[model samples]
Target: MPRIPLKYMLLPLGMALSACDKGLEEINRNPNASESVSPEFLLSSVLINTAYDYQREAYWEEPASAGRYITLVRNEDNDKFDWGPRGWDSYYARLSANREMMEIAGTMNQPEYIAVGKVLEAFNFAYITDLYGDIPYSEALLSKNEGIVHPRYDRQQDIYPALLNTLKEANNELSLLSRTVDATADPMYKGDALKWRKLANSLRLRMLLRISKNYAPAFSVMQEILNEPLKYPVFENNEDNAEIGYPGDIGVNSWPGGPLANAFAEFDKRKPSKEIVDALAERDDPRMEVWIAPVDDPNGGRMYMDDYVGVPNAIPAPYDYNGGSPHISRLSPMFNSNSHPMLKASLMTYTELCFILAEAVQAGRVTVAGKTAESLYYEAIRSSMRYYNVEGVADIRDYYNLPGVQYDGTREQLITQKWIALFLKGPEGWFDHRRTGFPQFTLGPLAASAVIPKRFIFPDTERAYNEKQYQQALVQFGEDRAGTLMWYLK
Candidate 1:
């Protein structure tokens, strides 16, 4: 028997069909060509691709641009605010594979496999909707077979509820799977269904909190999950974090700009923004040292400065790319180095969950058995510090004693910490800033508009190919500008 590899990830719609035909031809006598590809391989490939998407690419784009977390001395398009419609065409491509995995899993009668697919489906949809407010949800990714090429765009308001439902139903299905299968392909949790279940519940909580400000019904959903802990287990600690692990030696698995990919990064043009460095410095935050490298200031000659400094966001050209200013710092060696191949692509962390719980409690959404908002807030900070091995227990305690670090019972405090903790994780910090308006970012002199960007423009592909649907969606939203506030923000 010949071994057929069944790897499914982000394949373009046209390419996917062509690949399927090729696979079918190769595996003669197998009418169900897809059966030659195991659901395990499909799940693994999707997980790997998703990790690479978040950790390598989006780390330097929307998330960095939105939060003023990193300064782009290279392309600087996102910096100068020359905003244009961004595409989710690749997301649709991935979803096609996702839909295939669901079909294969269903045919095998594997509830866990089906649940995992739904979770990924919901996650990608949520990510796209979060960035581009209204998007094609119900009728997307069905062009080749279903022939629904021009799918209607769904409102974010409607999309969020559907995503939440998908997650809820997925978690229920995951718990019902009794047979334990080898999950070596699962990089996030090693194919542990329980951990995935936790992630599902935690993600549901995250989505609910995201819309709770605008959608009151979300509060009820939050209450239902909080009311049942066993049914909806959340991240208990850093161990339960859903991060993609890297091999450190593998070219594909290492950090994007690290030493292994030196050609791609040339000592990295990306640096921490002044907003974050200054904030962390003021709080005497230890995480700063772990995050950034001292500037290689070329003042008459090259020399390293012990202090951390960063470039201001959205500044004009004639900028310093070669460390001309003493105030510009490079990224930390841990991130930029090739040695720490174990650097994870963080999807979600216990620290984030604690912060979410902290916020939920402040808003009277949920309550821990004996913990107060302050307790959870402090734990959240400690969990972040511990996760990164930034500070010792004593050092963490001392740092919390700083005037700004203590829990002030304000939502601003929770939001601020969460923003700092979410560096390079992709888009969540930006999303938080847009929704809460905390850890305030200033529009630089070169800003395209006076306001900070709220939502990403729908991709030009939609306007060009799916013109009617795109036009209807644009008209419903009023404008295609980056500064337009999304529904959730409103």
Candidate 2:
């Protein structure tokens, strides 16, 4: 009787609505809206964006043109070495996502995600420091949490060691076999934790070797990884390569220069550079056919010794060089397609690792049991051939035996082969060129700069928004110019 009286009284008075209003904020919240995103989703997004950016830098006109892999026939700022301050915004965007992923994973106690995040962070940071010399590291991505809007630029020397340490820590954390990763989230290795571990160690090797000339302990750190197979496993074969494939089903996910993403005329403007084309043609490299198309003859006759004709880089009116567009070789038709099996965005590869090891041995930095510099050198070339699907087409040994192709225990030979294998691999060829000066490049007659660029100048955003920090960085580093040598080079 009492319960009925209260319920009936509230219903009549409209006080029953008060009960529904309790926790109304929770109930009124949109179920479709996500207050927080999942770590896996963040990870997946970061990986895709990173891969696409990397592939673009590798295959697109700017970096490729700068690295002498291709020549831009029109709008040739990069070709003329008229590079301004290149931005690191895209890299920081991915790094910001990666930083968030790590934070959420930390709260969730997901060690695997944390480890993967560390690896990615190290990778991105390495590139940033390598390219720009000094960058925000210790205080970076702290605006939301620590309120550091203008993070100090960390020295490249200091950043390199920190990156190497981060990779080491990631490798140790990834050694835990009980932890699981989302297979779908990992575009490069498909949830293979061990492969990620290999990549961490392999990338460590790359970083170590990159700074070996300047960094004293690089060789010893490299030795530790090389000697320990089980603990510090590296890429054993091409299957262990850290590469991602484009779905190519949509404009956003398609290859950078592919038909879906770029116009045919834009693609046509990028012709193979004489530096790379002549190197391949002289060696009778099968990859020449895979990477470049045969030149179309105007008079129904071949223009060069081979049908392939590459344009001179940094030359005046490059569009008219080698007798206009029709006479010059375009990139292979495979590159023009929306997607192809060979069209992968590589983070690192076993071919590169082999070349790294070969260089290490030749330089007497580290030794592999039962392996000589020459053997690894040949293996490096063979792995490259196999990676390109040109292995079975010709006897690899014959190519190896050719003059300038044989192992001579010279750094030039080792790095030159690496440069060839590093085609379309994102700034690696240029990095090696800066490091070793192998496959020597010359400035064209019309080049704007007296010397090849060493590192990119700091972006305008940094100079504008973070003026104080930018000034401080320049005081420590030097004038903000592309020709200024970074710490590693110094």
lDDT of 1: 0.76
Local accuracy of candidate 2 as per-residue lDDT tens digits, 1-490: 0001112222322322234554885777566755555677777777777777777887784568767898888887888887798888878878987887888888888878999999999998998888889899999899868999999999989999999999999999899758667987777787889999999999999999999888999999999998998999999999999988877887667777788888998888888889899889778888898999987764543345458888887888887765666678899998888778898888899999999998888888789989999999888888888988898764854787788887788888788888888888878888888888887888799898866788887899997899999999889999998889999898
In Å, residue 249's CA in model 1 sits off its true spot by 3.7
Residue-level lDDT of model 1, residues 318-384, one tens digit each, is 1463345554687888777644633677777888888888998987777777788899998988888
List per-prediction Cα lDDT, in the order shown: 0.76, 0.83
Residue 305's lDDT within candidate 2 is 46
Report the lDDT of model 2 for residue 402: 83
Off by over 4 Å in 2: 1-28, 298-305
Each prediction's TM-score against the native? 0.90, 0.93
Question: Candidate 1, which segments miss by more than 4 Å at Cα?
Answer: 1-35, 262-267, 297-306, 321-327, 339-342, 393-397
